[model samples]
Target: MTKRSKAFNIKKGDTVKVIAGKDKGAEGKVISVLIDDQRVIVEGVNRVKKHEKVVNQGGGNTGGIVTTEAPIHVSNVMLVDGEGVTRVGFRREEATKTRADGSTYTVQRSVRVSRKTGKDI
Candidate 1:
């Protein structure tokens, strides 16, 4: 079996605010998560420019100076919950699951919680 990536409190499509670095105070939707590196790419945040060389003159993968969002350390961002940013907390709750053979079982699953509101985020 393929190795599994570590779970993170932040996930793709989550709104996050940059807490440090050049993009501090900026809030944007999460574009992707880098589990191993503990970094995340937030839309329109931590943008960097890269110059590319044209691979072909036929309009395939046109090369030029491109500005794109760079991955920032996960610690530099805070998940946006409700009206403001809040620290992420995890709690376990019982959930029912169906077995492959048709048996039902209860399992505890970790849920993301908002530190500020004490509600599921």
Candidate 2:
């Protein structure tokens, strides 16, 4: 059986700072996540240019040099908090929730916390 990997704390739309690589110290919002490859694409980070040939499509033939952000390994980036870049930690908390039957139940939820500040992110 294949094992499923745990989800990363850094989600889409999260602000992250690149810690290592050519774009080190660059900060930008996360564009997408590649869980299988353990990589992420950050806005304005790891940009690369691609040359393309013009092709005729249903619309029109419009192709040229396209520059876009490339995927960066997740380990090279750190989540950014109000203080600065911080490591992520998980915290379990009990919370009460209402069910469809109007019954209250206590459930445990895992929340992502900042290691540096010791607060929920």
Candidate 3:
């Protein structure tokens, strides 16, 4: 049997803070998300040195001991809100809309909300 992983609420472009690991307390904007590995690469967090070979393709590409952000486990980070790090929650809301014939209908939408303040994120 196999288990499915839950979708991550943290997405690219969101500000997050590291809650655990060597980079604990570090805060940065989320640069990318690795859903399959359940890891997130936050800007300026979990940096590591990489050795690369210089390529003679187009413009000269210099490569040697380059420092870059490394992927951190998603669970070690928390989304940052107005009041600081807080857990994320989902809220479903109904919206009423009218069509060209003046007919009304309802649609449901889900939004990410802050658990601490219960406000939309």
Candidate 4:
């Protein structure tokens, strides 16, 4: 048995603030979301050093101690809404879609919303 990836409200480029972790209170844009791992990689957060072996191929990439951002658990960060941080909420709204044949249909689409301001995220 393995864990499955679920839909997460957080997305790449969303600004998030670390709530509980070594980087508490630190804020940065979300670089990527790892749904399966239930983790997120925030820009400028969770920095780690990785050592690599030099590969030899015509102009092979240089390998050494490299600093990179590591993934932090999603529970450790909160989305930043304007001046404050808030929880992510979902709102279903009817949206119109057009088919290739020019036929239009209405569908309910879930939109990421801010729990604090009741605004779309």
Candidate 5:
């Protein structure tokens, strides 16, 4: 059997804010996560320009400079919650229990709370 890999609480569609680098304070939704590289591509962070050459296609076409966001290390991003502040790890109230046909499934929740106010975040 293949061993399961460590679970990263962050998901692809999560909102995050850049805490470091040239794009500091920029916020965007997560596009993709690279677990192996520990990187994430935000909607508008670490933008880099790419020069493209026009390829001859029978029809009219053009190629020029395109700006795209490059993946930044996950450590550089902080998950932003409803309050729009950086999150600090905290314990959840309890595991959600689901029962179907007498089978129970307990889903563990990871809560991110405010580091400053000590409230749910």
Candidate 6:
């Protein structure tokens, strides 16, 4: 059996929909990607509470629960566009020759879009 490399098609800023966890079906922007771990942290998904202690100069530290987002497995999410359609692959545009002006310009590239907006960021 061939070992599959841990790689995520999702990128930073890519809008993703959580397919699992407590935030299932929730959509948010990708805040960061942990390629090595095959995990990505969405803007508002997989929230985990962290207990923190406040150290005082005079006495001991006070502990409390701090709510924050946690890293989710990339496989549990899907990339979505403004039309709410999921994306499968990365879209890249190559420079092509134009006849009229003969100048190089970027064309409309098909990339993943945010489900909230049809515009690619």
Per-candidate count of clashing residue pairs (backbone under 3 Å): 0, 0, 0, 0, 0, 0
Best by TM-score: 4
Q: Write the per-residue lDDT of candidate 3 for residues 7-115, one digit (tens) a residue.
A: 9999999999999999999999999999888999999999999998998889676978899999999999999998589999999999999999999999999899999
lDDT of each: 0.92, 0.93, 0.94, 0.93, 0.79, 0.77
- For candidate 6, write residues 51-99 as lDDT tens digits: 9888787886576888888999998998876556475654555555576
| Candidate 2 residue 105 C-alpha distance from true site, Å | 1.5
The candidate, 2 or 3, that scores higher on TM-score is 2
3 versus 5: better lDDT goes to: 3
Residue 105 in candidate 2 has what lDDT? 97
For candidate 1, write residues 26-121 as lDDT tens digits: 999999999988899999999999998878866677889999998999999999988899998999999999999999999999998999999998
lDDT of 5: 0.79
| TM-score for candidate 5, residues paired by index | 0.64
Error of 3 at 52 (Å): 0.9
Query: Candidate 3: where are CA atoms >4 Å away?
Result: 1-3, 96-104
Error of 5 at 85 (Å): 2.6
Name every residue pair that clashes in candidate 5: none
lDDT of 5 at 92: 66
Better by lDDT, candidate 6 or 4: 4
Please give, for residues 1-121, the per-residue lDDT of candidate 2 as tens digits: 7668768989999999999999999999999999988899999999999987888988665889999999999999999999589999999999999999999999999999999999898
Model 6 earns a TM-score of 0.63
Instruction: Please write out the lDDT profile of model 4 over residues 1-121, one tens digit for every residue.
Output: 9976788878999999999979999999998888889999999999999998898989887999999999999989999999999999888899999999999999999899899999898
Lowest-scoring 10 consecutive residues by lDDT in candidate 4?
2-11
Residue-pair clash count for candidate 5: 0
Question: lDDT, candidate 5, residue 21?
Answer: 93
Candidate 1 positional error at 107, Å: 1.2
lDDT, residue 92, candidate 6: 58
Who wins the lDDT comparison?
3
